[model samples]
Every structure is written in C-alpha cells, then in structure tokens.
Target: MEETNLYYKLGGQKAIRAVVEEFYRRMLEDELVNEAFRGIDMDRLRNHQTAFLSYALGGPVEYDGRTLREGHKGLNITSEQYERMIRIMNDTLRTFNVADEDRVKIEAFLRSVKPFVVGQ
Candidate 1:
C-alpha cells in the first residue's frame, strides 16, 4: 500500500497551505462554523489550521500551540459538531483533489482525535 504520508512528501508546504486556506475559507462561510468561531481571531485561527494539518501530515513544522483538548476546553463540542468538522475536513481534501490514500490518512487522524476533541 502506498504510504499516506506520500501526500506530504509530494507537495510539502505548498500542498498543506492550499488545503488549510481552502478549509478555513469554507469554515468562514459555513453558518455552523461561523457561529462557533465567533469572537475567535481569524488570523490566529488561520495559523492554527495550517499548523494542525502540517502536524498531522508529517511535515517538518512543529506545532507548539495549546493541546487540542486544552484549546477546545469548555467549548462543549457535541458529537454533531465533531461530525461536522470531519465532514468539513473531508470536503476540504476533496476540494484540493487529494488522493484516496491521503484522504484515508486524514480520516484516520481525525478519528483518533475525535474523542479528545469532542469529549466523548
């Protein structure tokens, strides 16, 4: 099987940058996410988005920001919220024409983080 990290190996920073920018743009226009992001700094959110993808995709960049749980602490994210985020993530990958293997890796990573993120 082709390694999922191949996506990162293939496109490096440029590919990750594209996916994150598109993802955040979509989030900004999404009513659910827009409301969730209310009062959050868009610029910082943008950076976090990129750092997140980079970290997950095995890029050289190291994300030193708050832990996912800590950052989302007290947000009380529901299962629905977690599903929506996963859907958005999949859509974002599709928008960038990510390959199936890479998409699988993304899905796996999201699944791994779901419980922590949603407090399940």
Candidate 2:
C-alpha cells in the first residue's frame, strides 16, 4: 500500500482553509495561546497557515511564507505556549473529524517543527 498525503486526506483546499480558520479561532479564544496572536494580521496569518499546513501535510501547494524561525523571531515563545497551540490544533482537527491516524501524523509534523518556532 502507498502512503497517503494529509492534504488530500483533509479534503484539499476548501477543508484546509476551514481548518486554518477554526484553528485560529480556537487559538484566539484560548487564553494560553491568545496572547501570541495579539496585533497580528489574522487574515494573512490564516493564509500563510493554510499554505504552510498544506505544504507540511504533503499537498501540492507551496508555502510562500517566511520560515518558521524567521516568522517567530523575537516572539520569546515558550514550550508551554507551543504545546498549548498544538492542543488547540488537535482539537480543531478533531472537530473537523480527522481520523486518529492522520491527526497523529499532523501533530507529529507540528511537534517536529516546534524547535524552530519556539523561544528566542
């Protein structure tokens, strides 16, 4: 059997965009990660996040956004904040009815990249 890409498993561009929107909504409503989004351009953030997740999830789309390290530079993000965001993302995925196997893969991918996005 061949491995499947999450982007397609996630129902392509439409579903990915919905996931991004829901993820941001969850993040902003949750106190743990809400502060990180203050004064940020949410529309642009959603676009970049959609593209990045699409790319990370093995979609055909390419992310044109800044590297995670460059984007997170000077944020002084903490591991706790990062984990919190992951939790919110998982919740969003669950809400979208993503299968456990796929969600695990997505979470793993996000965690693998955490070092690049966290801390000074």
Candidate 3:
C-alpha cells in the first residue's frame, strides 16, 4: 500500500521546504501579514517552520521552536490577519497540488491551533 503519512505523501523535507518557501514568499508579499515578520530572522524562522510543518504532518522530525502562543505573543495579530494567513496557506498548498483530502486535514490542523496563534 502507498504510504499514508502526510509527510511522506507530501515528499518529506524537500517538499515541506518548498511549501514553506512559497508560503513565506506569499506572506511577505502580503501587506496585511508582512508586518508580523518584520525584523525577524528569515533563515531561522524558515528552519523552525520546516521542522514544525514536518512534525505537524506526522513526519519524523521534532519541532523545537517556541510554542505557538509564545512565538506569536505581543504580535497583536487581528482575526482578519489570522484568517488571511490561513487563506495564504491554503493557496500555497493548492499551488503545490496537494490533494483535497490532505488539504482538509492540514487546514483542520491549522485551525485547531488558532487560539494559540491568534490571541497570543
């Protein structure tokens, strides 16, 4: 049987890196979301995100980054901004041709973390 893990299905580290790169590109281009990333270390953030995504997708990697609330704390992210971020992520996944079922699962995972990420 084909591997059912989302990490494997999405082509592991390489594919997750590609998605994160594209996702950050879109986010940085977006006026609404770009401010949150201002002055942050892109390389470090990218690495953390890659690891985080891998773990989120059930990969072998463990995420050692800050907790969602702690990382986003003091950012004062608005609900609209949070929603926009989700849309961008959905768009990024679609651009990568992720299956609908997989996208749904991913979206659900993201949404499940909304409280921790939004009101930080």
Winner by lDDT: 3
What does candidate 3 score in Cα RMSD to the true structure? Answer: 1.6
Model 1: worst 10 consecutive residues (lDDT sum): 1-10
Task: Select the stronger candidate by TM-score from 2 and 3.
Answer: 3
lDDT of 2 by residue, 14-106 (tens): 999999999898888988778888899999999988888878878888677888999999888899999998889899999999999988988
By TM-score, the best candidate is 3
Pick by TM-score: 1 or 3, better one = 3
For candidate 1, the lDDT comes to 0.76
Q: Per-model C-alpha lDDT, please?
A: 0.76, 0.88, 0.92
If candidate 2 were superposed on the true structure by all CA atoms, what would the RMSD be? 1.9
Steric collisions counted per model: 0, 0, 0
Can you tell me which runs of candidate 1 are displaced by over 4 Å?
Answer: 1-10
Global local distance difference test of model 2: 0.88
Off by over 4 Å in 2: 1-3
